[model samples]
Target: MSDDLQKELGVVRDEIDAIDAQLLELLNRRARCAQQVGEIKARHGEAGFIYRPEREAQVLRRIQGLNPGPLSNENVTWLFREVMSTCLSLEQPLSVAFLGPLGSFTGSAATKHFGHAARLLPQSSIDDVFREVEAGHAHYAVVPVENSTEGAVGRSMDLLFSTPLKICGEVVLRIHQNLMTREPSLDRVTKVYSHAQSLAQCHEWLNRNLPNVPRISVGSNSQAAELAMQEAGAAAIAGEAAAERFNVPILVANIEDEPNNTTRFVVLGRFDAGISGRDKTSLIMSAPNRTGSLHNLLLPLAEAGVSMTRLESRPARHTLWEYVFFVDIDGHRDEPKVAKALAELQQQAAYLKVLGSYPAAVY
Candidate 1:
């Protein structure tokens, strides 16, 4: 290389190294701040350790609102999520198990939520994540709850009945899927591989564009990408992470039929709530068989000025007619009005369980 080119290369390499050192220092400072926050939380209660969703959403909005945009909105949100993850680690090293054979969306979700600090355990089955948490091998577990396209993850809801673990926080990941393959041309593609949900979300696109191509379901979109990397005439529908991991080319990007497609995931753990000025609480209850029972249950919440975010009914285990309602409400259980409402609710419900309240997850 010429002397001028070599000088330019040396300057770039030195600049990169300097940036790395600065990043390391910034990360350490962030970790220390997190430790202090954890200590403050612990002095109040144990529940301080768990995450809360409302806080996280609020943080994300605030970050976007203040961003000057050398980095995009998404980039800022991701950076904060990583900071939160690292901060949480300083309090204690947590092991979180999620549905995965690695590189699955669940794995990505777990890592994104936990940051670079937590030990992640990948399990093949959703039930296995529950099992690992239940057996004390993991501090927490993450499982898919609902998808914008296909609806609830039935197995996760069913497992909720069988396990003692409580939902600690929720994560909603925007789904962006791409058609990727080694085959360079769309004409060369004869088969598709992806998770069932991915296929369902892209149903219209697949039928309209590649009607004759056979679709095969796999455990995850990442797994499909792996298969595509090894097979000719095959393509996978998955996220950008999978594409980078598998080194496969994205033949068609954002193939998911719905632009607003998203998947909601829930965190399961034993920790209770630490007071976050803003928070939400989840409750499971069953009302009496008679008519005014459901109304009676909701009236107190309305009177308390609590907004109900989610309400879904599951068949009460071993009971033909009874149904349990899983509710997500906007306020901490410890709040004066919420406590009063729960007290009133206890009188009207056949069964009531107060799931743990934690510091709302913050971005």
Candidate 2:
């Protein structure tokens, strides 16, 4: 190596070392500040307010907006997320529950939003996750509400109607389903197993590639991977995390029908999130059984100039042939325009329930 080149490399290494030292010092200083904030909250009898979703959302959004990058905005935000997660844990380590055997997309969503510093509990079913939070065993619960490719998660939607929990936050995860198996060759596979939604998402790919193989719908993709690990001729359609966790070999990657398949998960907690600048309000309403009742219910929102993002109908469990409509609007419920629309709609509807207003997912 040339002497000049060696000298330049040494100089760059020293600069990097100095930067690392500075970063370590700053991080420790920040953690100390976080600890002091916790102490102040305790003194004011507001310790439970340490994890504020609105404040965190504002912080992340501001960081992304101000980022001038060699590193992408996402990379910067992710680093800060972990830093904040660590600082929050210093206040109180959060217990989060998600639908899982582990390695499910719901579990991934929980980790993505809460960070690895949180204590994640895996529940067998969506209902179990809600129960865990409701029973005070968990601080929050994460469950998949909808998928871009396959549409709504019916069980999760139904649970939302009954559970007293509020929607405190949302996370959108890009899903990449893979075909994995224990066998060395795909030619030897005779059966496929996966969650019903996953199987549906990869339906076209499965039909085209494994034409003769029978597909089975299981409870979750993680459970499907578990079965594939134990069986010779079985393949599972799941995310890369499941394959890695279960020690299965990937036979095919990106097997879903859509390249941009994404799932939206909601965080359920005891208290509703305060308004973040960019927010979404979700609610359920059942119109009176009359000719123009549904039309009347929606007319106020449109007249009030509030944009409705989504609407889904679920069967009301107590009343036969009666359906309740779940709606997502573009603003927080406390906003004057939104509040006016909701008030008018309440007068026209037979039932109304404001689920919660929460910050929209940041990409």
Candidate 3:
């Protein structure tokens, strides 16, 4: 730590700063070119010029295919995701909404998908998220659809059944549950609080460590952290963001039983991802009650060479033996083959609702 050495180090840091500035300038220049491409498309009267998943995928894959540097596959994917997100924003700023109060996982996922620069709004409930997008208050809304540890988020499914909003995009987020507390000692911990799913994910840890302590379920993990701040004897199971927001110390990090725990969030918006040659269409249909009725309903898709991605049953709400099948299949609604398949499917279904067709998340 001599003065000469410090001066030399400072000079190196200045060079690093200069290199960073140049890199940023190059990025902006590239983004401007993307904006020009968008402008050209706009001048040609192309409808909805911003998003192009196929082209983006091709670009990223080409970059990865040609990459020779130290940057790994994931590094390149992340970098391009940000770069494309920024470029798209230049064409048109994306307005996104998510379940609110800031530090929630849905909020984090929304930010992750659209980037921090996108105009993000927070809604109080899942239905409100749909309403926001439907009412044109926001371009899209990110809502938790399902979790690996806890199955489906029922509220989102229910909203899907009721709302006209289409599923435009999807995001998968890794869930890490942290036990945060204000108490300095585990011995002083009297109670644990967290969201219902977080508690379930960390049930083994809670039972093993604080067997005698009572566990309470709060509205959200962030709320649990806030509760723990007021109650010194309590700890909260939540994400890292919650811990930082509440200024609670993380007692046990990554307490979820499964390390590969991830949640799938769906983006609902006024428009679908459009006819990207590769995509998935989600629909709700009810078949007549018969042994072969379900089989017959799916037969048309099979005949058309369509692949079903997901099929989940939910109660139809009105009658005693009635149910709605939420079907997701690999095809776009606008495609001729898919359109024909759906037309045939209608003959078999008592009720059919084409929820949406959107580009499947490539990851």
Candidate 4:
């Protein structure tokens, strides 16, 4: 209420307003440059190829590195993401598909990776998401691959084996599940619903709190939230976004067993991403069913000085009891050492498929 304090606050506000004007001018200038870039690409007959994951990754990384700020690096990168998304949309709007009824974590990952400027199409199933992109109905698709707590999404892994689309990018979303319902109190709740992965993620918490409630696994957390909206005695476990989307109230928050629960999602597109300095490659390989076949498959990567980040096995769908391995390595396939290793592994393995070499998640 002091005059001096009021004057100081007014002055600061005026300065902020002035800086915002400058930022607006600069943003428009940047958008105009983006438009020019699109026109140049079209002139070279490269129309409909506006997005470049490697390039965007480089830009975001550089921005984060150079950031001198009161705002955190994640916040800075997110602002730039929206800016780029908007500029890209001005050039040509992109259509992205995700497994959803809307408000699913996969949908959130798609938005996080692609931004709100892109049109989002929610599919009924993961297979539908892949089919949408494969049929050219969508430029890209986002699908959940794995979770830190509950492990790999079996359906997504199975679909990846058959889908011709490559992984162009990846998003890692930290999940915070909440118990939500339309009802006012948990005392009235009789049934709990959520995606199987989510239910598993919150298994311990559910057992501790809603011990007597029957837990039902649904296709998506969004679908579960929808059901909660309809049924009086039903509660759904999902993210905060789903609560807002469905106009449901949160009964409890952070109910997952692990506080650091996260889900990894992959963006699928027709072409693989080019090398970004910090990149990761995903591949599927099957070794001949023989002793030492598995060990021999990994030797080349170690010999080539490539570090393996993750390895998982899934049943080869066509042949019963046969297993295929999915591996994530810490380098692009085009790198000299990586190429050498992959070539050696290809010859040694019964089958090999390079899923993609994409920029690693920035954060």
Candidate 5:
């Protein structure tokens, strides 16, 4: 390197150091403000709910809107999310549970939404994940509800139908299923492993790359990573987190058949969130078992001028042929239009339960 170049870089380094110091000072000031807010809430005898889903979403969206960036909006949002998370922890660290063996995509979503400061408890099953929060052992739960490529997560949807936990927030994770193994190349891989959903997501890639390799479906992605770590001539289909956590080498990157493969996760909590301007309401309802009853059940949403975003159906338990409908609609449940639609919906439906309304995923 030339002396002139070194001198120029050294000047920039000094400026960066000064900026670092200022950031440290400002971060502490913000943290102190968070603590004061907590104290004030304590004085008022309010229920101490430190994690405000709507408030956090509003802040992230506002930050993204105001970004004048060399850094992309996503990078800026992530940085600010960490800062807010750190500040919130100064008030009270949260406990979040997810289905896992650590390094599962659900675990990543939990951290993405809660930040690393929150204590994350990994459970064996989706039922256990819900139980952890419902029993007050954990503050919240993050569970996958659906995927873009393969559709609904059946177990999660089934649990949501009965669980008392409310949907307080959501996360949308862009899935990048990598081929990871101890071997340097895919040629030596005799077998493949991954969760059923992940295996389905990468089906086309596997057919072209390893036509004869036996693809095994395991309980979770992390478990597949674990098997690959110990088994010879084996590879796992998982994400960066699993590869890193298990120290497996990634032989192929983003092997998902769909380029835009994504998974949607919902945060389960006991209480509901206040309205965020752009919000979504999720609910489960069943129509009367007569012809045209399902259409009648959904007519109120259109009549009230509320947009319906998603509609899914699952077989209702205890009834051989009956099914329940899961619906997502624009606007918070608190909004007048949404409230009116829901009121009308309640009158026409045989059964109805508003899972909860919350801020939509910021991304």
Candidate 6:
């Protein structure tokens, strides 16, 4: 090798080593601060759910805004998330529950919001995920409330209405659906396995490329990937986590009909999240059995100058005639305008429940 080239490489290596040492020391110092926080909280007799969702949201947003790096804001946020997660472990191990077999998008959401340092409890169903947190077996539950491609996840919404758990945070993951199989090409494939939502996301692709192949809906894409890993002439449509977890090789990548497919997942816990500047409050309300009841119910928000972001109707389980309306609004419930809207809404609606008010997804 050229001596000049070796000398140049050595100089860069020396700089890298020095930076690494500095980072290690800073990380340890942050960890010590975190431990001290936990200790101080304990001394004050206020230690509970040591993980703070609102504070974390504020920090992430601030760091992202301040980032002026060669690395993208996403990369910077991810690095800081991991660093914070590691430091939090020095205080207390955060526990999170999610819909699983461990490779589902829900699991990815949980890890994304809570970071990898949290103990993950994989539940078989969304109901199980909620029950785990409600029963105090887990610190928090993460579940997919909606997908951009497939619309609402009916089960999650239903559970959210009934569960005592509150929505404390949210994670938005950009989805990439891959067709993975052991087969060299699609020619030999006989069947495709995926969650129903994934199948719908890739519906056009499947129709064009594998029309004759039977598509089977499963409990999750992770389960689909597992089956594909062991079966002959089989392929699974799943996210990268499932593909990696089940050790399936991707033959075709990002086959979703919509190129910008994304899923929004919510964090559910016993406690509420404080107001972050940018926040969303979810609610379930019912209109009276009158001609203009629906419009009347929403009038409060308009009068208060509060913006309503989403409104969906579900069949009220208690009555045949009444419909339950799930609403998402722009501000936190505690904010003055939002609070005034709710105050007015309380008088008009037959029923009202504030599901949660949490910071909006960072990205």
Q: Candidate 6: list runs displaced more than 4 Å.
A: 148-152, 187-196, 206-235, 244-248, 319-321
Q: What TM-score quantifies how close candidate 4 is to the native fold?
A: 0.87
* 2 against 4, candidate with superior lDDT: 4
Q: For candidate 4, lDDT tens digit of each residue in 1-363?
A: 999999999999999999999999999999999999899999999976779999999999999999999999989989999999999999889999998767777888888898889999999888899999999999999998885423337888888888899998999999899999987887889999998988988999988888999999887777888999999999999888888888889999999888888889999999989999999999999987888888999999999999998899987889533889999999999999999999999888888989999999986
Model 1 CA lDDT for position 42: 77
Q: Which is superior by lDDT, 2 or 5?
A: 5
Residue 307 lDDT in model 3?
90
**Model 5 Cα lDDT, one tens digit per residue, 1-363:** 999999999999999999999999998998898888788888888637767899999999999999999999989888888998889988888999997867778888898998878899999888899999999999999998985423338888888988999999999999899999999887899999988988988999999999999999887777899999999999999888889999999999989999988889999999878998999999999986888888888999999999888998888996443989999999999999999999999999888999999999997
Q: Mind giving the per-residue lDDT tens digits that candidate 2 earns over 48-93?
A: 9888888888989999999999989889878888999999998899
Please report, in order, the local distance difference test score of every candidate based on alpha carbons. 0.80, 0.88, 0.81, 0.89, 0.89, 0.88
Would you estimate the TM-scores of all the predictions? 0.74, 0.88, 0.82, 0.87, 0.89, 0.88
Cα-lDDT of candidate 1: 0.80
User: Where does candidate 1 have its weakest 10-residue lDDT segment?
Assistant: 46-55
lDDT of 1 by residue, 51-109 (tens): 54445556676887899989998788888877776676667777999987577667777
What is the C-alpha lDDT profile of model 3 across 34-122, one tens digit per residue?
88888888889974747654466456667777778798876776777788888788788888888885877788788777766688898
Best to worst by lDDT, what's the order? Answer: 4, 5, 2, 6, 3, 1
Candidate 2 Cα errors over 4 Å, as ranges: 1-8, 39-45, 147-152, 183-191, 211-219, 230-233, 319-321
- Residue 24, candidate 3: Cα error in Å is 5.1
Q: List the residue pairs that clash in candidate 1.
A: 52-360, 52-361, 56-361, 273-357, 273-358
Specify the poorest-scoring 10-residue window by lDDT in model 5.
Answer: 147-156
Question: What ranges in model 5 sit over 4 Å off?
Answer: 1-6, 147-152, 181-196, 210-236, 242-248, 319-321
Q: Alpha carbon lDDT of residue 192, candidate 1?
A: 97
The per-prediction CA RMSD against the true structure, in angstroms, equals: 4.8, 2.9, 3.6, 3.0, 2.8, 2.8
Supply candidate 1's per-residue lDDT for 246.
88
